[model samples]
Target: MSLLFRRPTLTRLLLLKNIKQNQRSTICSKPPKEKIGPVQSTFALCVFAVTLLAPAGWIMHHIPEYRRQGQNTST
Candidate 1:
């Protein structure tokens, strides 16, 4: 039917128009990322260190495996 074909074309046109409008809008600007303050920064660091501790420990435990492989390959 003509409607089936025409509806998709109309929808495509509307979508293109919306995309162009969005491209022109300055309101799409990203928020500025800045240091929240020393206290917040310290808290974030503490959380990060806690999160990384387990992963770091696992990597450390594998150090002998990695070093052994490297030594064998070099000799």
Candidate 2:
């Protein structure tokens, strides 16, 4: 076991080295190319919120049905 795991292989070392070089910086300080108006921004935020919450709300709305099915299956 010790012999098999003794040293880092050449490919593994190269992979780690390449990974360090592949990262990109996400920092930005530039002003907007096209400014979004308040109405558009509000619409975008509302759509995003509904997209994230709708599925969870549907599941929460059906919890009683799920519980009834589980009880029926166990019996």
Candidate 3:
């Protein structure tokens, strides 16, 4: 009974050790990297800025219409 429990624990430890070794080896392998040029960087920035600001721009554009409708309904 004791052997049954101990065997699983030892097997688990061995499996965990193998997983850690594989992870370390994979992480240590490398590849060269490319740099982003100015045009690419500018385009990326424009896309990022538009994504960040488009929602606010849409809401700002619609606020006056919403206010006009609210005024008409109250009157």
Where model 3 places Cα greater than 4 Å from the true spot, the runs are 1-8, 28-33, 70-75
lDDT of 1 by residue, 1-75 (tens): 677665567888999999999889856577778748899999999999989897899999999999999999999
Top model by TM-score, which number?
A: 3
The estimated TM-scores of all candidates read: 0.36, 0.59, 0.61
Ranking by lDDT: 2, 3, 1
The list of candidate 1 runs beyond 4 A from truth reads 1-14, 22-35, 58-75
The ten-residue window of minimal lDDT in model 1 covers 1-10
Q: Is candidate 1 or candidate 2 better by lDDT?
A: 2
Best prediction by lDDT: 2
For residue 54, model 3's alpha carbon misses the true position, in angstroms, by 1.5
Q: Where does candidate 2 stray beyond 4 Å?
A: 1-29
The 0-to-1 C-alpha lDDT of every candidate, in the order given, reads 0.88, 0.92, 0.89
Residue 19 in model 3: lDDT: 96
Query: lDDT for model 3, on a 0 to 1 scale?
Result: 0.89
Cα distance off (Å), candidate 2, residue 65 = 0.5
> After TM-score superposition, what is the CA distance of residue 71 in candidate 1 from its true location, in Å?
21
Q: Model 2: which residue pairs collide? A: none
Q: Estimate candidate 2's alpha-carbon lDDT, on a 0 to 1 scale.
A: 0.92
